[model samples]
Target chain A: MGDEFCSCDILHENLIEIVKKKMPQEEKLYDLAELFKVFGDTTRVKIISALFEAELCVCDIAVLLGMSQSAISHQLRVLRQARLVKHRKEGKVVFYSLDDEHIKTIFNQGLEHILEPRGFEHAVF
Target chain B: MGDEFCSCDILHENLIEIVKKKMPQEEKLYDLAELFKVFGDTTRVKIISALFEAELCVCDIAVLLGMSQSAISHQLRVLRQARLVKHRKEGKVVFYSLDDEHIKTIFNQGLEHILEPRGFEHAVF
Candidate 1:
């Protein structure tokens, strides 16, 4: 299986060179991966999804997802650290929302990939 | 910490009701998180980034990323399973490219998020 999938020879060194030059710095890519890892959790995704419709407090997110407020708060901290979601204080209450439109766009783009029909036959690597 | 961050009361039942009605089914959200989880890996993100530049064979990808052919192949399989990437056979070599434009858009959106400056004060909650 490995032999069939991976050739020892560099098939296209020219293309590789070009791509290498254009690729983002390793540090940036690492940060990008970390950012996606934040979204990779079910609880955080639910919080972001709920916030997509309306700004939400921790208690509200917990209620919406049928989870405890403490659990919701933990995920909110992750989201905030990644800067995917931000919060505002209204007196004693705090409302959390997507930091910007890019969160919604990123989520929708993934949804599009999931929703789109596959054009090619599934290959076993 | 928990008390300050998470209120016991449902602050916005009306807003929760609206978001609840509009939220995608839980199963769909689960699938969405799974898709993001695929993007969370550094190797997979690097592979996707390279493919963004041009379609290339596994060996080419392995060369560009300075990783072993077997490691690249493993990541390729995960990418293929998630439908984030597609492969085509050209004679004896197999070339992989992103599954669609959505993949690029998703990656770019994440990039935008990382690049954008935080507008709000970082909250501790």
Candidate 2:
């Protein structure tokens, strides 16, 4: 199946050279993949989506997500470690919010991809 | 560890209610995570990055990434399955490119997150 779809004898040498030059460093690409992996989990994605609405304490996030505070906390730790979220202290309570605006932009971009009409379904395979 | 950081006795009922209303459906969030998971792999990310430069056949992508054609084809199949890439047949060669511009925007957003100075590193823990 693989060969049938992509066994062209002639490689596009010029195109490959250009793309290789433009490709990010291998380490950067690995880090980028690691960052996206943080978003791949449902729990973390929920935490991120909730943070999008407003900053919230762990208890609030747990209640909102209908999950245990521990479970939410675990995911929050992962998110914080990835720097996709940051916490602020107000008196005794710690509130979590997105690390920066770029997170929201990234989430919205992903949402747009899934929400948009996927016209490629009918493309020749 | 979890409790120390988030044992606030009072849940923010009002905030939870508001965010709950604004939160996307569970199915949508699940789909969103699945979509991001497709981008969470190093090979797929490289494939997407290459397509960002120019459309190319599987063999070209294999050469550009310094991977076997079979490996590149596998990742291309995953990308195609997720609708992150679309392919066209020119004669006998199948050339692939990003499904839409949202992919590039998404990649840029992720890039910005990693490239930006993360001020949250110094945030109070």
Candidate 3:
């Protein structure tokens, strides 16, 4: 698959046409990359799931995840910065919830894909 | 935000209610983390964007991104294994496209979040 991927075969006409018509700008590509990077963390994803169904404060998140309050706080900072979660203050407690539906959409979709009866991601074995 | 997040304050009543109702299982959290991790790479994100709009062979992907066919092919393997993209062969050329629509939804949502008029990810961010 390696060298073959670079093989000097004549280019496919359809591929060439599509590339010319649909190529994205470099900055948009970079932005897309950064966005995915935000999702790539284990702790963050768990935090996201915890927040998916309810708004939670740091202490609440910590307890739900079986993590320390300090740990939940750190990840929440990352999530808040990524715009994956938003918050409001009630007295001194900051309640965090998913910023939008995309988190759940992506999560559920991925889950569905993996859980498909056929296999996990086209046969992990 | 630091120490306060860990303060021994009694948990808020609403928070306890939500956490109890919403906490996810551990294995699901791990799987969710793995899913997000798949999205968290710059090169992979670009590859995803390109495929979002077109079915591409390795050479084509390399050309569109000004990358080596070898490099694009490497990333394609990762994408395929993750089930973020799928491929088919026509003669000797293998073409790749997104595995499904989740990639697009997630990407578009992140773009919308960051590009919001007020600011990015909570002011500066």
Candidate 4:
């Protein structure tokens, strides 16, 4: 039944089963894709990366990026909808930071790999 | 000179310097975005997620995802160009896996944070 994949040097049955257990259907794939897409934007990534160290209000972010307050606010809205970032209100100012630590770890790990070179062998496909 | 950003409460001067050290110009932000764009695909993400576990040949990966070898190959190509995945040729078979341990660590940390909830607080911004 799944011979085509086997013949083409793709994945085998065991791998299919394993992937299915986690993703179930292709929709889950889309879901995952959308999540990554959020990080694919420069403005968003900048905001996220900045938040990695300290929480900042819109004004601070704007000053940091040399952008306008409106521009920063708009990007913040998109990030909030994606659940990638969250906001807190203090006095008349609002500060934004990562929604979850999952995101922080992901960014940190990626940066770590980019900065460090080791353990990544040119073995396996 | 940077009064606006300070007024908005977004980021501070120090963050701008740090981010600038890595990204330099806005163009670097675009380059980074393009890199993340590869992971923005479900097929690619699944492929990456799978590679995180075991190094599977194309056929094995196809079977695992119940996808066509052609589809898997195409996605693999994208990953390869992005330096996200690398291939190894052994006789008539080729295996593919992540190009860096940084990617693996990123994924692992993301999963860790998603699966476990701790150390993340609703403080600061």
- RMSDs, each prediction? 3.9, 3.9, 3.9, 5.8
Give the Cα lDDT of each candidate.
0.83, 0.83, 0.71, 0.70
DockQ of each: 0.58, 0.55, 0.51, 0.40
What docking grade does candidate 3 earn?
medium
The CAPRI quality class of candidate 1 comes to medium
Best of the candidates, DockQ: 1
Worst 10 residues of 1 chain B by lDDT: B1-10
Docking quality of model 2: it rates as medium
Provide the lDDT at B7 for model 1.
43
The sequence of per-residue lDDT tens digits that candidate 4 reaches over residues B1-125 is 44453543332556656645654346655666676777777788888978877777888777777688789899999888767888899887898977876666655554444344323442225
Q: Which candidate is the best by TM-score?
A: 1
Query: Model 1, which residues run further than 4 Å from truth?
Result: A1-11, A123-125, B1-11, B123-125
Supply candidate 3's per-residue lDDT for B43.
78
> What's the iRMSD of model 4?
4.6
Off by over 4 Å in 4: A1-31, A90-92, A117-125, B1-32, B113-125
State each candidate's chain A TM-score. 0.83, 0.81, 0.77, 0.70
Clashing pairs in 1: none
lDDT assessment of candidate 4: 0.70
The DockQ ranking, best first, is 1, 2, 3, 4
Mind giving the per-residue lDDT tens digits that candidate 2 earns over A55-111? 898888877777887798789998988888889888877899987788888899899
